[model samples]
Target: MFGWRRRNRTGRKTGRSKKQQFKLDKESVLPNHFRCPISLDLMKDPVTLSSGITYDRESIEKWLEDGNFTCPVTNQVLRSFDRIPNHILRKMIQEWCQENQNSGVERIPTPKVPVTGTEVYEILSSIEASMKRLDQCGFLESLKKINKWGFESERNRKCIVDNGTATTLANAFVTFSSDDHHQSLESHNYNVLEEILSSLNWMFPLENDARKILGSKPSLNKLVLLMKRRDFLSTKNAILVVEELCYDQEFIEALVGIEEVQEVLVRFIKEPICHAITKASLMVIFSMVSSSNHDHERIKTQFAEMGLVTLVLNMLIDGEKHLNEIALGVFDRILDSKEGREAACGNDLTMPVLVKKILRVSELATEYSVSSIWKLSRIEKQSNEGRVLFEALQVGAFQKLVLLLQCGCGDSTKEKATQLLKLLNPYRAGLECIESSDFKNLKRSF
Candidate 1:
C-alpha cells in the first residue's frame, strides 16, 4: 500500500503533519469506478436509477428527498425513481475492500432491499384472503408483518398507504365495531380485533376516506376503548387514529357528544402522562373545538361542563414546554364562552401558570398564553363575571405583561399583553403589594 513515497509540493516526507499521514495510511487513492459521482467518495450500497446512473444509496436518497426529479450525472428526467441495487458492482467493491484491508478499508454490509409497490399489494392480498377465511391468527400475523415492514422504510410506508392498507384495516375495524356484542368475542377474536385496531393506528397520513370510515360512532367507541388501555404505544396509536378521524364538523360533534370520549381524552391529558398521547389528545380537541363555528358556544359549553377547563389547566401547570404551548392553544380556543372563562379563573393555578409562561417555554407558548389571558380579561370586562382581573393582580400578571414587552416577545403577544394591561388598569388599586418598591417601580415602568 505504501509502495511509493508520495510527497507534498515541497517533496519532503519529514514535514508531513500527523493528520495527513493518517489520511494517507487509511484512505489510499481509490479507483475512479469505486467513487460515487455525487459525493466522489468510495461507494457504499450503490444503486442505479432508471437513468442507468449508479450512485451511493445515501447520496441518491438525499437527492430525491431534496425534490430532484432528474438523475445527477445524466441530468435527464428519471423514467422511474425505483432504486435497483448493483449487486455485481457491490461484490466487486467488497472484494477490493478486503484486498486493501491494510489500508483500513471496511467491507460494506448487504443492504436491505427497498420495498416495492408490488410487495405491498401481495401482502394486502394475502391479508384480504386470510381475513375472508376467518383465519384470525393468520390475519393477525400478516397485519403484524406489514406493520413491521411499514416502520422499516419511508418507501414501505408510502407503498402501504397507497395500496389501501389503511382503508382495508379501517373497514375491518368498523365492521367488527358495528357488532353490538363484541364483548362476547372469543379470546382469539378479541386479540385479532386489537391487532386490527393497532394496524389501523400504524397507517400514516390516514386520508379523509379512511378517516370517514373510522369516524363512525361505533368505530370511535372502539378507538376510545383502545386508547384507554394501559399500554403506552397502543394507546398512543389509538389517539393518533382518533385525531386523524376528526376531519370535519359532523365528525367532531359526534366525537364531542360521546361523553366517555371526552372524559378519556381529558384523563389522558391530565394524568400518568404519555407525551405523544397527550399531544394527540390536545390536537384532537383543538380540531373538534375549532371545526364548529356555528355551534361553537354550545360545543365549548359541553366541553366546559365535562371539566375540560380544569383538565387543561392542570396540564398547563404540569406539562413540558411543548405540551404547555399546545395546551395553551387549545385552552385559548375554548375560552370563547363565560363558562370557559369562569372555569379558568376558578382554578387557582391558571392565572399563575399563564403569567409564568409569558416569556418562558417558547415564542409560540408566549403568544398562546397571552391570548388566553387577553380573552379572560375581555370576558371579565364585558360580563362583570369572575374576578379574573383581581386574579391577574394576585398572580403578578400585570408585572409580567410589562416585562413581556421589554423581553422581546412576539408582536402579537406584546399587543395582547398591552391590551390586557390596559383592560385591568381599573383594578390596579386591588393589588395589596402596589405600594412596595418593586411593585411601584414596575407599575411606573408600565
Candidate 2:
C-alpha cells in the first residue's frame, strides 16, 4: 500500500510540472505574433490581426483599412480581423474589455481652452510688475555706482573693457539721447549739468528722474567737451546724444542750435573713430535740416558746400556694411532737398560713382547679403537715380534677377530689384549683357 501511494504521488507531481512549463510557453509565444508594428509594444486597445482582418470585441471586421500596417518583425501582411485564431488571446481581450467597463474608465478627448481678454490683461500686468522689480534690483544699483566712478576718474579707456560699466553707459547714453526733456534739463543749473555729465556712464536706475533731467535744457557744449575729454570709444552712443541735443525743438528755438552743433559734429566726423558713428552723425545733421521747421538753407548749403557730399560718398565706397546703410540714408535725405539736390548736381557729383555703388549693392542683395539692401533700394526709389540702375543691370544685375526668378522666391529685395529693373528697361541692355555672359550654365544649376 505504501509503494502504490508513493507511485501515485510522484505521478501527480510530474503532471503538475508539465502543465506549468506549457503555460510559460504559451505566454511567450503569444507576444511574438501580437506585437505592434509602429511601437513594438505588446498589442492592446483595439488590436488588429493578419489575413486582412481586424478583431475588436471578439467580432470580426472585414477588409481593415489599408495603410503601411504589417508585422513588426517579419513585415507580413495583416489581412483580416479573424487572423488571430488563438482562442486564449480572444478570451483575454474580452476579459480586459469587461474589466475596463466595470471600472468606469472612459477615454475622452481633451478640449483646448482659449485665452480671454481678462487673461491677457493679467499676463501683461505680471510682465510689467516683474520689469519694475528687475529695474530696482541691487545689481543695477551697483552697476550705476561703478559707472559713476569710471566717468569721474576719466577711466573711459578701462571702463569700455569693463562689461558692467560699458552696458550701463550704453543704456544711459541711448536713454538720454532719445529724451526731449533731457535736452531741456541740460540748460538748467551748472551744478546739475555737471552731475549729469559725470554720471553719463551710469544706467539711470530712476527712470523718472533721468527723464526729467534729460528733457530740461542744460549746456550741451559743456557735455560735448566732457565726453571728448573722456575719450568715450562708442561713437554710435555719442552720436545719439548729439542728435537729441541737435533736434530738441525748444533748444533749437534757442540761440545755440544746428549751426553751433554742426561745427562740433563736423569736427568729430573728421576724428579717427569707427566710420559708422561718423556716418550716423552725418545722417543726423542731414535729417535735422530736412525735417526742421526753421529756415536752415544757410546751414544746409554750408554743409553741402563744405565738401560733405564728397566725404560721405568716400565713406560709402570704403565703409563697412552697417556704415554703408547710414551713408546711403544720408545721400537719400540730401537728394530729397531741392536745394541739396541742386547743390549736389551743380558740383557734377551725383552720377556714375554713386550709381556704381548702388549697382554693386543690388548685386549683393541677390545673395540675401544684408539688411542694407532694403534701405539702399528705398534710397534708389526716392532719388529717381536711374542711370546707375541701368549701369547696374548692364553689369550682371539681370543675371542675379534671372537666378532669383528660377528659385521662385519673393521678398522685399526681389520685389525692389524687379521694380528697379522695370524702370531701367533691363531687357534692352541688361538682357543682352546676360545673354552674352555665361549665366546660362549658372541658371541650369538653379
Candidate 3:
C-alpha cells in the first residue's frame, strides 16, 4: 500500500512539470514582429505591442487584475491566475525599477510649449519701422520734453533734499565734469548731437546752454544774479556746461557772434581764487589756441603781461610731488612762448632766484626738481648775467650730477649735465680749475 501511494505522488509531480514546459514552449514560439522598435533589447519600459499600442507595467497589471489577461496572439484568453504564463514581464519591470532607483530619477513626459522667436523678431522689426518716422521737428519736440522733465527732476531732487528725504540727488555737475563731451561731440554726427542736446535741454533746463540761453541778454542777467550770490558750486556747473558748448564748432561760432560770452568768461577769470573756474576757462583758451585761424600770439602776450607767469611760477613752487608733472608742463608752455620766456628770464634777478630754488630742490634730491632744472638750463637764453647762473649750478650742483651719473638716473639727465658742464666750462674754465687742484696724492690713489 505505501508503494502505491508513493507512485501516485510521483505521477502528479510529472504532470505538473509537463504543463509548465508546454507554456514555456508556447511563449518562445511567438514571432519577432511583436518586438518594440526602440531598444531592440526585450520590450521593457512602456513597451509597444504589434497592435500599435503601448502599455506600462501598471497597465498590464490592471488588465490582469480586471480578469482580462489575454496575449491577443493566440486569442488565448486566460481565466485562472495559474493559467496566465509568466513571460519574463516581472524581470523587465524589475530591471527598469532598478535602473531608475539607482539613478535617482523618474521618467516624465515632455509638455508642448509655444515658440517665441517670431514675437521677438516682430518687436525688433517694429523698432526698425519706427526709426524712419523720426524727423527733425519731431526730434526737437522730443528734446524739449526731455529738458522739461530734467528741470522738474532737478527741482524735485532739491525739494527732497530740503525736506530731508532719504533720496540722493543725482550728481549732475559731477557727471558733466567727468564726461569727455568734447571728443564725443567732435566724433558724433551733428544731426544726432542737435537732437541729443535738444533732448537734454528739454529734460534739464536751458540754464546750462551757453549758446542758446546764456548767450542771450536775459540769460546773462540770470547768471549774473546767481554769480553775485557766491554760489560757486552752481557757477562751476554752469561753466562746465558752457565749456562743453564752447567745444562745439557751431556753438563757438554763435559765441563769437555775441561778445558777451567772452566778456563773462574773462570777468570770471579776473576774480580771486578762481582755480576751478580757471581750469574750465583754460580748456576754452586751449581750444582757441589750438585753432590755426586764431591769433595765438596776442593771447600769449595778454596772459604773460597779466601776471600769469608769476602765478604759474608760484604754483610750481607750491605744488608737491603729485602736481610736479603739471607744474613742469605749465613751465614748459610758459618758456615756449616769447612773452612767457621773456617774463621768466626777464628781471635779471628772476633767473638767479630760480637757479637757487632749483639747487635747493636738487639738494633735497627731488627727481622732478632735478629734471625741471635740467630742462630750464637747456632752454634758458644765456646772457652776461649767466655768471650768477654758473655759480649757482657749480656749488654742489656738479656733485648732484655726478651722483646721478653714478646711479645711472637716465641718459637724458647725464647728457643734459654734460651739455650744461660744457656751457659752464667755456674757455676750459672748469677743466683748468680741476687740474690746478693739488692731486699728487689723489692721482697716486687712483
Better of 1 and 2 by TM-score: 1
Per-residue lDDT for 224 in model 2? 51
Q: On residues 1-446, what C-alpha lDDT tens digit does candidate 2 reach at each position?
A: 34333235445323335566665654554444444444443344334466433333112221233344554334676553234344555455545435555344233222112223343344334433433444323333443444444444322323333323323333343333433243432333322223334444243232333333443333343445333443444334445444544444544444235235566566555563656457557656656555555555666566665556656655554567566555555555555445555554433233323444442454442333212223343455678775444544554554555555565545765675566556556345424443223322221100
Give model 3 RMSD, 1 decimal.
26.9
Worst 10 residues of 3 by lDDT: 164-173
C-alpha lDDT of residue 218 in model 1: 76
Per-candidate count of clashing residue pairs (backbone under 3 Å): 0, 27, 8
Model 1 per-residue lDDT tens digits across residues 169-238? 8776766666546544242355666777667765667877777888887777767777767777668777
Winner on lDDT (2 vs 3): 2
> Which residue pairs show backbone clashes in model 1?
none
Clashes of 2: 27
| Residue lDDT tens for model 3, 87-177 | 4553544444456553442323221121133432443244233334533344344334333433544433233223211111112222222
**Residue 325 of model 3: what lDDT?**
43
Give the 10-residue window scoring lowest on summed lDDT in candidate 2: 437-446
Candidate 1 colliding pairs, count: 0
**By TM-score, who's the top model here?**
1
Which runs of model 3 end up more than 4 angstroms from their true locations? 1-231, 242-275, 281-294, 319-324, 347-384, 391-418, 425-446
lDDT score, candidate 2, position 282: 61
